[model samples]
Every structure is written in C-alpha cells, then in structure tokens.
Target: MISTGEEVLHGDITDTNAAWLSRLFFEQGYALSRRTTVGDQLDGLAREIEHCSLTADIVVVNGGLGPTSDDLTAQAAAMAANTGLELSEHWVAEMEAKYARMGREMPETNLKQALLPQGAEILDNPVGTACGFVMRINRAIVLFTPGVPSEFKIMVQDQVLPYLKALFPSVVSQVCQRLYTFGLSESGISQTLSSLVVPEGVVIGYRSALPFIEVKVFAPQNCPNVSAFYRTIIEMLGDNVVGIGQPMLSEISGLLQENAMTVSVIEEFTGGALVNELHRDEACASLLKDGRFARDFAKTDKDLASLAEAHRRETNADVVLVVGGKRHEAVSVALAGKGAVWVQQVASKRQYSQSSYRTVIATLALDMLRRYLCGMPVFGHYESLSSLSSFSNERRTG
Candidate 1:
C-alpha cells in the first residue's frame, strides 16, 4: 500500500485509512506485505508505485485524488504505467449531475477529477467527488482511492474486496479469539499463562490498552483443541476475565438490564469520567437514576459508605456507587445496597500521569459494581495497586 499526501507524510493528519485497511485485509485472509508513504511530489509517488508493483501482486494507492492543485496521483499513476492521461466523459457527466442535484454548478477545476490513465478501469465513488480507478503497472495491479475515510471504506468493501477474493481463490481464512481482562499488568498476565502449551499452528499474543489487557489467539479454523485451550486460559485467569471480544462497560450494562436494577453515582477523584463511561451504554443510561460530582464529602471509608447509603435512599435506586480520594493518595470506592454496604481502598504502586490515575480509579469503581452484580468478591488484586483497607456491613432488622 502506498499512502500519498504531504499531510500524511509529515504527520499533519493521522493515517487512519491505512490502519483500517490493514485490519480489513487481514480479516479477509489477505495480509498486506508492505506499506509506504510518499508526499504529493509526482516523481516520488511514481517511483514508489513502480517499486511496489514489482514485489506485490496488488498495490493500493491512497490520497492525492481530490480537486485541489496538490492532487497529483492520476498523473503519477500514468507516469508509472507509461501511458497518457485520458478524460472520462462519463465521470464528468456524473459530476455535473451530482452538482445539479445540489442546486449548484460544477466548478471547472472538478473536471480534473475525471481525468484517468489510458486503459484504466473506473471505480465508482458514491459518497464523494473523488472517483477511484484501477490500472496495471508491470507485474502488479494498482488500485487508486480517495483520502476521504467514508468514501474509501465503502469502495473497498463494495468493490476492492470482492475483486481480491475472485483473484485469489485459495487463500485460507484464520480464526481469532480475544479475551478482555482488567486489573492485570501485561507482564503478570504473560507469567501466569507461561506454562500453558499451545497446539502447533496456534499463536497467542497480548496487547496492553490502558487499564485493560487483551489476549488474542490465532489459529486455523479446523484446530480441534482451540476451544479447550481457550477455556483453560480463562479458568487460569479466573475473576480477572471480564468478557470475550467486548469491554467491561458492555458486560456491566447487560447485567444491569438482566437483573432489572437501577443505580445512582457520586464521584470525586475521577471527576465525571465514571458517569460518562456508564452513559455510553444505552441500557445503562436508562437505568442510571442520578449522576453527580461531589467534592465536599469526607474521604474516610465509613463516611463514604454513609454518603452512598443516603444517596441511594434519596434516589430510591437499587444501588449507589461513590468514589472519593486525595490526589496522589489512597482512593476509595463504596457500594451501598438495600441490606449491605461494601467499601475498598487502594493506593497506586507506581507514579502515573493525572489522566491515567483518574482512568484507573474509574475502571476500579466499575469493576467493583460488576463483581457485586455477578455475586463475587468486590475487591480485586491489581499488580500496579495495593489494597489499603476494606469494610463491609450487613444491616439488621427487628
């Protein structure tokens, strides 16, 4: 793949198109062999296209297809293929019709978009003005696409992928399974699963994305022991496992709806991030009775428990969650329910940025509620955090 434009080459804009394409192709059993970035210079773009054509069976060229003066991909493609540019009268009419629908006249400069290399096949772009095209350069088939993410993605799905599948019929698809876990460091997760043996042609990998660690397994679709191997790893990890191919927030939301429970939240150290994360799920949002930012409350576990209970009574919710702490000190999470109150306090084992610290606290608070809902222990052990104190109380009735 050759990504073109000064913005992408100079890092002025993120190349999300490349990342999206890589994932898309991998999932379709066609992994990209190489990726290259070139500026808007015609000679450089032509050179890169010619270079990739010799090594790859297929090459995708992105960007430099707009109507502006900087758009030079069409010329570069023509140079690489040793052909002259020819105007596509059909695309010119399509552009004119599109502008007429919008109640405006098409600009003269837009005619440049209709210009294509000789003997190239036009790839229609339904969402934007920049049209895509396909041409052959030496041994490789080069496909050109616009830089707009929406248009590029749609064209790849509707046009490029089908063409590739027909071109390469014998490619075998691989199966991938993902497990999401929180409160465990990447090294700790690796050490815990180090003794397990994986079958041949199966690969296990770990990726740390902030407060959660993702474990991914890749194997052939016909692997017989993959399911059992996956279950064993989950059992070894125990309560740290939150979901499969889903985040904790989604898991918590499902539990809340299944149990028909409503909740109110009060936060301090994490600001309003706890509420924001909960509101992201529609089911959770509907069940959330109240969400507030509280700063004047006492930081003690007993006081936090009392505050949560009071809020629960005020909102008449099934549960109330409260978080409070001083910066760079121990943080506390309290859960108040109908007949019991639970609180846990922990301190960070290493220094973290303010945003990261807040994110950890917020995730910890959510995990506590999730555990209680699942009928498990509310306090969890984390490698980067140490428990300071815990409290639990069951109310009595006469």
Candidate 2:
C-alpha cells in the first residue's frame, strides 16, 4: 500500500487512513507485505507504486487524488502501469450530472478527475468528484483512491473491498475479538497467559493502550470454540478483566442500565474527570443525577461515608461513588447504596502523569461501583462489610 501526502510526511495531519486500512485488511485475512508512504511529488509516488507492485500481489495507493496541482496519483498510476492517461468520458458525464444536480457548474479543474490510466476500471466515488481507478502493474493489482477521508472510506467499502474479495477467492474469513483488562501490566498479563494451551486455528496478541491491556484473539470463521479461550483468560486474569471490546466507564454504564440503577458522583483528587466520563455516556443522562466536586475533605472514613450519604440523599440516586486521598500517595473509592457502604483504598503502583492518574482514579471508582452493584468481590488491601458501618479511610503501606 502507498500513502501519498505531504501533510502526513510533515506531521501536519495524522495518517489514520493507513492504520484503518491495515486493520481492515488484516481482519479479512489479507497479508499486507509492506506499506509505503510517499510525498505528493510524482517521481516519489510513481517510484513507490512501481516498487510495491513488483514486490507484492496487491497494492493500494491513497491520497494525491484531489483536483489540485499537487494531485498526481492518476499520472503516477499510469507511469507505474507503463501506459498513458486517457480521459474517461463516462466519468466526465457523471461529474457534470452530479454538479448539475447540485445546481452548480462543474469546475474546469475537476475535469482532471476524469483522467485514468489506459485500460483501467473506474471505482465510483458517490460522495465526491475525485474518481478512483484500479489497474495492474507488473504482477500486482494497484488501487488508487482520493485523499479525503470520507471519499476514501466510501470508495474502499463500496468498490475496493468487493473487488479484492472477488479477485482473491481463496482468502479465508477471520474473526477478531478484543478483551480489555485493567490493573495489570501488559507483561504481567502476557506472562500469566503464557502457559495456556493455544487452540488450533487461533492466534492471540496483546496491546497496551495505557491503563488497559487489550487481548486480541483471532480465529477462523468456522471455529466455534473461540469463546472458550476468552473465558479461560478471564478466569486466569480474574478481576483484572474489565469487559470485552469496551472501556471501564462504558461497562459501568451498561451495568447501571441493566440493573435499573442510578448513581451520583463525588470526587476529590480525580477532579471532574469521573463526572465527565459519566456525561460522555448517553445513558448516563438519565442514570447520573448530581455530581459534586469536594476539593477538601477530612481523611476519615466517617467523613467519606457522610459525604456519600449526603450526595445520595441530595441526588436521590440508587448509588453514590466517591474518590479521595492525597495526590501521588494513594486513592480511595467508596460505594454507598442498597443499605450498605463499601470502601476500598489502593495505592499507585507506578508513577503516572497527573492526567493518567486522574483517569486511573476514575476507572477505579467505576470498577468499585460495578463490583458493589453486581455483588462481585472487590479487590483492596482493607475490606469492610457491614449493614451500617463507618469507614476509617487511611492509606496503608503494604
């Protein structure tokens, strides 16, 4: 694949299209031999396309398909294919009709979009004037697409993917599942699962996305027992497993909606990050009622319990969650509802930036609330279980 853009090369814009296409192709069992990104210069673009075409069975070139002067992908495609450019009358008429439907005359510069490599097939772009084209170079089939994300995505989904599937009938179907976990380092999680027996036709991989580790399980479409591997990892990882394919806050939102419960937020050290996360979830508009920011509070369990109860009573919510403690020392979470209160305080395992620390505190508070609501075991150094108990909140050294 060849990505052509000066913005990407100069760091003016991120190359998200390359990442998206890579994942899309990989999930469909396509072997991406190499990905090459080039500037808008015609020489570099043509050179990369020519080289990739000779080395790989399939080549996809994105960007440089605009109507601007720097748009040279069409010409470069012809150069790579060892042919001359030909004006596609069908595309020209289509562009004219499209502009007429929009009550505007077709720009003369847009006529450049109708040019294609000789004997190339036009890939229709329904959303834009820049047309995509497919042609063969050496042993590889090269596809050229526009740089605009909307147009590029539409062309790939509507035309390029279908063509590749039809052209390569032997490509197998693969299913990729992601399981998210927290409170465990990526290396630790990997070591924990290192001894497990991997099933046939299944491939497991791990990636760390800060505060969470994702385990991606890839299996053949016909494999019915893929879920068993996921369950085994969950059991082995224990409480570290948050949920599958979602963040911790999202999982908490699902649980709240499923159990028909509402919650109020009271955070101290985490700033309003927790409240912001709750508001981010659409269902939280109904589930989250009142959020309070307690900048200063006594470090006693009695004070935390009182704060939680007062927040619950003021907001009339089924549950109230609290986050407190000194920065860089430790954080405490308290869940009060259903005639009980549970408080757990955990220290920072590693030094993190203030933003990351706030995120960790927010997720920890949400996980605590989830466990309390679901009757799952809560992980903490100190645990207090009582119908009406007061918490003595203090950071303890291990």
Candidate 3:
C-alpha cells in the first residue's frame, strides 16, 4: 500500500485509511505485506507506486486524488504505468449533473478529477466527487483512491473488494476470534498464554488499545480446533476476559439489559466519563436511572459505600455504583445492591497522565459493576494496580 500526502508524511493527519484497509484485507486473506508513505511530490509518488507494483500482487494507493494542486495521485499513477491521462466525458457529465442538482456550477478544477490513466477501469465513488480507478503497472494491479475517508471506504467496499474477490476466486478467507480483556498488561497477557500451544497454521496476536487489551487468533477458515482453542483461552484468562468479540462496556451494558436492572451512578475524579460510556448504548442509556458528577467526594470506602446506597435508594434503581479518588492517589469503587455493598480500593503502580489516570479509574469502576452483575468477586485483581483494600458490608435498610 502506498499512502501519499504531505499531511500524512508530516503527521499533520492520521492515516486511518491505512489501518482500515489493512484490517479489511487481512480478513479477506490478503494481508498487506508492506506500507509506504510518500509526500505530495509527483516523482516520489510515482516511484513508490512503481516499486510497490513490482513486489505486490495488488497495490492500493491512498490519498492525493483531490482537485487541488497537491492532488497528484492520478497523475503519478499514469506516470508509473508509462501512460498519459485521458479525460472521461462520462464522469464530467455526471459531476455537472450532480452540481446542477445542488444548485451550483461545477468548477473547472474539478475536471482534473475526471481524468484517468489510459486503459484504466473506473471505480465509482457514490459519496464524493473524486472517483477511484484501477490500472495495471507491470506485474501488479494498482488501485488508486481519493483521500477523503468516506469516499475511499465506500469505494473499497462497493467496488475494490468485489473486484478482488472475483479476481482471486480461490483465495481462502481467514478465520479470526477477538477477545477483549482489561486489568492485564500486554506482556503479562502474552506470558500468561505462553504455555498454551497453538495448532499449526494458527497464530495469536495481541493489541493493547489502552485500558483494554485485545487478543486475536488468526487461522485459516479450515483450521481445526479453533473453537476449542478460543474456549480454553477464555477459561485461562477467567474474569479478566471482559468480552469476546466486543469491549467490556458493551458487554456490561448487554448484561444490564438482559437482567432488567437499572443503575444509578455517582462519580468523582473521572468526571462523567463512566456514565457517558454506559449511555452510549441506547438500551443501556434507557436503563440508567440517574447519573451525577461529584466535584468533591470523600475517598474512603465507607463513605463511598454510603453514597452509593443513598443514591440507589433515592433513584430506586436496582444497583448503584460510586467512584471517587484524589489525583495521583488511591481510588475507590463501590457497588450497592439489595443485600450488600462491595467496595474496592486501588492505587496505580506507575504514574500516568491525568486523562489516562481518569480512564483507568473509570475502567476499574465499571469492571466492579460487571463483576457484581455477573455474580463474580467484585474486588478484582489487576497486574498494573495495587489493591489497597477490599471489603463487603451488609446494606442497611430502614
């Protein structure tokens, strides 16, 4: 894959297109072997495209397909294929019709977008003005796409992927299983799973996406024992395995809805992030009885437990969760229910930025609620955090 643009090269904009394409192709059994980035210079872009075409069976060129001066991907592709650009009257008419519908006149610069390499196949862009095209350069088929993410993604799904599938009919699709876990470091997860022997033609990969780690198993669709291997990994990880094929937040939200339980939350130090995450899911949002952000709250477990119980009673919710802590100090999470209150106190083992620290606290608080909902031990253990204290008390009812 060749990613072209000065913005991407200078880190002015993130190349999310590359990440998306990499994952998409991997799932389709055509994992990208290499990624190259070039600036807006036509010569550099052409050289990279030519180099990639020789090595890769298919080369995807992203960016530099706009109508502006720096939008040189189409020209670079024509240069790399040793062909001149040809105007596509069909696309020009389409653009003029589209602009007419919008009650505007098409600009002359937009004609640049209608130009294509000689003998190239047009990939229609339904969302935007910049159309994609495919051309052959030496031993490889090269596909060029616009820089805009929405248009690029749509073309890939509607055109490029279908073309690739038809071109490579016999390629086997890969099988993948993703497991989400929190409270464990990537290295720790790797070491913990090291003893498990994977079957031939299957590989385990780990991605640490902060606050949570995603473990993936990639195998050929025909690979044997994949399901058993996945089950064994989940069992080994135990409760730390927050979810399979989803994140902990989504999993917890589903569980809440399944149990027909409503919850009230009171939080400090984490702002309203905990509540906001829960509310992101429409079903879970409906189950949230009350959400309050406390600017000042006592960090003691007793006080937190009391606050949670009071909130639960006030809102008449099935459960209440409380989070409070001082910056750079210990944090406490409390869960109150009909019969009991569970409280856990923890301190970070290493210093983290304020945002990261808040995320950690919020995750801990949510994990506590998950454990309570699942009937597991609420005082969970984490490798990166030290457990200060954990205790349970009977709820006082009047």
Candidate 4:
C-alpha cells in the first residue's frame, strides 16, 4: 500500500483511508500483508512501491493524485514500473465531457491527472476527474486511486473490488464471518477462547473496535465445519455478543423505535455521550426525550434512585437510563422501566479511556433497557444493586 501526503506524515491529517481499506479487504477474506506511507518525494514513493511489489501480490496506492504541484503518485508509480508517464487522450476527453456537464471548461492543470504509467489501464472515476489506474509490476498488481474520500470509496466499491475479485477469484471465494462483542474486556475474551482448540485451515483473530471486540474467522467457502466453529465462539461470548456485523449506536436506537418506546436519560458520569449516541438515528431521535446531564450528583445510592424515578415520572418516558460514579470509583448504571429499576456496576480500573469507558457505561445501560422491554432479564440477581422491588405489582424474574 502506498499512502502519500506531506500532511499525513506531519500529522496535519489522518490517514483514515488505510483503516477503511483494511476492513474492506478483510471483508473479502484478503488480509493486507503490509502498509507503507510516504510523502510526495518521488524517490521514496518509488522505493516503497518497488518493495511492496516484491513483498505482496497486490499493492494499493492511495492519495497524491490531484491537480496540484504536490500530486506525485502517478509519476512515482511510473518510476517504480521503469516506464515514463504518457497522456491518454481518452481520459482527457472524458474529463472534458465531465466538466462540460458542469458548465465549465477543463483546466490545464487537470491534464496531469490524465497522464498514466505506460501500459496502465484506466480505472474510471464517475465521481471525480482523478481517474485511477491499475498496472502490473513484477509479480504484483498496483492500483492508484484518488485522495478524496468520496472518490476513493466509490472507486473501490464500484471498480477496484470487482476487478480484484475477478483477478483473484480463489482469494475472494474464501468465507469470512465477524462477530461483534461488547462488555467483555480483550483479556477476558482471550481467556475465554484460550481453552478452545480451533480446526486446521480456519484462522481466528481478535480486533478491538472500541466498545466492541470483533472476533473474525476466515475459512474456505466450501468448509462444512464453519457452522460448528461459529457456534463455539457464540458459546464462549454468550450474552456479550452484540451482533454478527459491526455494532452501531443506531442499532439500540432502532430497537427503541421498533418497540415504539420513548427514553429519557439522566446522565451524571457519561457526560453527554449517551444522548449523542442515541441521536445518530433519526427514528431513534423521536424515541429520546428529556435528556439531561448532571456534572455533580448525590453520593448516596438512595438519593440517586429517587432522582432517577423523579426524572422518569417528569418526562413520562417509557424508559429512563442513568449513569454515575466518581473518577476513581466503580462506574454505576441504572435503568428504570415502568416501576421496576435495575442497576449494574463495573470497576473503573478496568476501563481504558474516559470516552470509551463512558461509552461502555452508556452501552450497558441501553442494553439493559432493551432487554427489560423485551421481557428478558436485565442482569443476573447477583449483579443487581437494588432488591426485586417495584411500585407496580410485576414480580421480578431471575
């Protein structure tokens, strides 16, 4: 991989494209062997490409394909392939037509974007003028794409993915499944899976995606034992498993919307992150009302419970979620449904970051509320702080 930009190297900009590409390839069961970054320097860029070509079967080059003086990926690619840059009239005309539709003439600087390495095939860009190119160098295939995220994403999804799939059908034919988990720490999860023996030819890897730890398995598409492999993982993860794909904050929000339930938040420890996460979905937005943040709160458990009940009654919400704790103490989360309340706490020492920790707290609170609405046990009796008591006559079940 070739990611070029002085801004990226200098930390003025983040290289999000690399992370996005990693997940994209992983989904197709192709693991990236290596990734290299270089500035707009011609010699360095050429050196990295040459090295990558020798090391991996495919090299993906992103960025530095603009109309500016610093845009040097095309020229660098030509140097690495030991060929000269040549202008393509077809691309020039394509750019001209694209600009014509916008009621403007093509600029001369954009002609640099039309230049491609000798014998390279144009990877058409419908969204932007910086059309990408693909070429073979030694034993590797190199693809150069635009730096703009929108252009890069479209090119990858529409052109690059299909091309790679066709060129390496066997690689793309492999089956991969990802299981997202929340609540469990990475070490805890590792310990849980450490005892299980995985079958040969099936690869299992764990990655931390913030509040969720993604358990990914790659097996041949024709493997009949894949179901058993996933079942073992599910058994180990248990209720901590959120879903099979990437876990989004909108999921919990969508659940509330589907249930036609309104929620109110009384946050003391999570700052406003819980509310912010809920607002990500518009349908979820309607399900949320009376969201408030308290910088300081009562230290006693009784006062906190009274405050949560009062907040729920004032808003007349179907569910009320509360999060509270001191910085050095255990983080506590409470959920109120109708007249019953459930609470759970975890040590703050195990948390990694302030933001991520607060996010986990919020996630736990929401998950509890979700289960409560579904008539599932919010938490085990041992984890519950308050006794099985409610203003309503509904008896708590284990």
Q: lDDT per model, in order? A: 0.89, 0.81, 0.88, 0.79
Clashing pairs in 1: none
What TM-score quantifies how close candidate 2 is to the native fold? 0.91
Candidates in order, TM-scores: namely: 0.95, 0.91, 0.97, 0.87
Backbone clashes under 3 angstroms, per model: 0, 2, 0, 0
TM-score of 3: 0.97
The pairs that clash in candidate 3 are none
Residues 268-345, model 2: lDDT tens digits: 888898899888989975788888887767476667777787778888899998887664365667877866666665
In candidate 1, what are the lDDT values of residues 1-398, reduced to their tens digit? 99999999999999999989986787667789999899999999999999999999999999999999999999999999999999999999999999999999999999999999999998999888889999889999999999999999999999898887888888766688889998888888889999999988787878788889999887777889988898888998889998776788989999999999999999988999899989999999999999999786864789999999999999999989899866448888898887788888889998988789889889998988898888888777787888888878853210
Model 4, span 1-398: residue lDDT tens: 77899998888889999889987787676778787789889899988888898888888999988999999988888999999999999999999999999999999999999988999999999999999999998789999999899999999999999999898877744577878776676777888888887876788878886667888887867788887988889887887776665464555665676788899998888888888888877777777888988866756555566777888899999888888765445666777778776665555445357677677677777677756765776863222122332232236643
The deviation in Å at residue 144 for candidate 3 is 0.6
Model 1, 73: alpha-carbon shift in Å? Answer: 1.2
Report the Cα lDDT for residue 337, model 3. 86
User: Can you give the lDDT of residue 221 in candidate 3?
Assistant: 95
TM-score, candidate number 1? 0.95
Best by lDDT: 1
RMSD (CA, Å), each prediction: 2.5, 4.2, 2.3, 3.6
Best by TM-score: 3
